[model samples]
Target: MAYAMLEKFEKYWGDYSTLLAIVIVLDPRYMMVLVRLAFSKLSIPVEVEASIKEIYDTLVKMYKF
Candidate 1:
């Protein structure tokens, strides 16, 4: 049971749901810090910088549209 829960957690941590991330970033209290913290918690190291940059770019694109 513990293993199953851990596996589920790892999967969730490793993947970023774009819309959810965007919403989180929009909040001043959290912003990118929360995203960075989430990725940091994952067992596997993810390229967080690029992902964050992409998110920023996406946000700008969305605003400009």
Candidate 2:
């Protein structure tokens, strides 16, 4: 019973792990470098890629006067 509960907890955590990581790594000092490094470590999961790409695109548009 304990093992089953732990497994479910892990599954739930894994689902949002990348989003949590991105929120942490998003800082002016590190900028995109740490974000890229984190994604590389995660082997570039598709959902993470989409999230990062959205942020990148938004930044590009913002800077493109």
Candidate 3:
């Protein structure tokens, strides 16, 4: 299931990245919350929270500077 989601994400990564970039520009904290909700909906394990946090942190850094 996770692999399936990852495949789909890869297929649409460009679009998703663009959207995330825009959203991060508007508000990175909110973007992180949205990412968390998205992963939760996908049934990502709580154990992967750190990985998600890293992604959110990177996104924040990209938008902040």
Compose the digit string of candidate 2's lDDT tens values, residues 1-65: 99999788767654444445445556667776777666555545786687678667766665695
lDDT of each: 0.79, 0.63, 0.60
| Tens-digit per-residue lDDT, 8-54, candidate 3 | 87676423353553465468466556666665655447734854766
Ranking of all predicted structures according to lDDT, beginning with the best and ending with the worst: 1, 2, 3
Tens digits of per-residue lDDT for model 1 on 1-65? 99999888878666777788899999999998998787666524557767777788899999999
* Deviation of model 1 at 32, angstroms: 1.2
Worst 10 residues of 1 by lDDT: 39-48
Clash tally, candidates in order? 0, 0, 0
TM-scores of all candidate predictions against the true structure: 0.69, 0.42, 0.38
Pitting candidate 2 against candidate 3, the one with the higher lDDT is: 2
Off by over 4 Å in 3: 1-25, 63-65
Give me the overall lDDT of model 3.
0.60
Clashes of 3: 0
